[model samples]
Target: MPNNSNENSPPKVSRQILRFLVIGGSSVAIDGICYALITTWSGISPDVAKGISYVCGMLFGFWGNKVWTFESTKRSVSEPIFYVLIYACTLGLNVGINRAVLLLAGDEFRLLGFFLATGTTTVANFVGMKFLAFREQLPADSTTSAPSSEPPEVAIPVSDRRAA
Candidate 1:
């Protein structure tokens, strides 16, 4: 189990990083497979296929990071809205990177361009998701109460005490 306290501390940060990496790997697989299937099976423009795959990946990324990576349970009417904001920013950056890479690398290396775009956007997404969008909140019970570090005192029943 990862420590939920001190997210900035080395150990907890490392845990978060590890969990983020796991979720990132899953998102990559989902995006890659969906993109391939959509492009191969459908006659739609590659841009359209890419957009659909990106949306699917974005939704999965949001849910996976919220529940598993951050274990976030904080509730607010604006959370989804905040998520949209992050999505838009990251998506725009990703698209920009893709176009730039394609232009620089040439169409013959399209796959490389795609990978570069994905890699850059993924790093940005992780940073935003970790620090802003779904920042971890302390467990609900932690706010109102504090647990003692000392061992808890337990009262023995009268009969058990006599036996001793």
Candidate 2:
């Protein structure tokens, strides 16, 4: 049988986690910059700016997570569509968490609300992406078959051996 030892090896979990964190950091930076710029220069309302920035940031996050974090080079047509669906679902969760935090903390502590909201969203996104979105990268099976040790053997009758 052909050697297949490497097939059973587990994925590089640490590396994947690190890449995810790095991509998430970059996405956060993009979101913050876009939010700040539009709010400051474009005369956009804070809510509108936040909405635009969130979309932009999500795009960045999707691309970064797909290409860099997961190392997925699949250019299949379904990939982007799947990503968009996930992003839209997560966006709703993000907004809901943000609003909930804001309401609980009251308007006086808006900064705290924002931080709490972002933190919760980040955790949720990471868990979802790592476990569900990129599960295909990891091996699906655990058991492997190795070659048997017993060798083929034959026995001849004593009478036949003597005659020969």
Candidate 3:
């Protein structure tokens, strides 16, 4: 049978990816604006301004991804921990890949290295955020009932069973 409803709608994963990108873009814009404002209007140093803006962006990204991109309802203490870990790993990956490409390809290919690193880290971030950081955890007891002392029941063919 044809699934008409499914045919009309994009897959759930696609929607999630789109939402994730939107959230990421927004976060970047927020980071840039905050950085500019801090650096321009305040006496804070550029490095400190960058750090503050980065934190602001990260906080917004976390909330947006958790509430909108993943549509997660139940909150776990480990979710933020996982998010931070994933981001940290990706950040390292991005820098390492960029540096490697620059070393191998020369400074002339700086833009190329930058793009490669960005692309790799973007994909890694998405996958990690989707599968690991935002994954729902089931309770240990939810998968099983309390153990019973009785033997398990076995089915018998109706024709072979004795009449009550």
Best by lDDT: 3
Best by TM-score: 3
Per-residue accuracy of model 1 over 137-162 as CA lDDT, tens digit each: 65545643578787867899998998
Report RMSD for candidate 3: 5.5
Q: Over the full model, what C-alpha lDDT does candidate 3 score relative to the true structure? A: 0.87
Candidate 2: residue 151 Cα off by (Å): 28
Please provide the root mean square deviation of candidate 1 (C-alpha atoms, Å): 8.4
How close is every model to the real structure, measured as TM-score?
0.60, 0.56, 0.79
Which runs of model 1 end up more than 4 angstroms from their true locations?
1-5, 28-57, 137-164
Query: How well does candidate 3 score on lDDT at residue 158?
Result: 92
Which regions in candidate 2 have their CA more than 4 angstroms from the true location? 1-11, 87-124, 137-164
Clashes of each: 0, 0, 0
Ranking by TM-score: 3, 1, 2
Q: How do the residues 2-43 of candidate 3 rate in per-residue lDDT, one tens digit apiece?
A: 333532145877988899999999999999999999999999
How far residue 154's Cα lies from its native spot in candidate 3, in Å, is 9.8
In candidate 2 the C-alpha lDDT for residue 52 amounts to 96
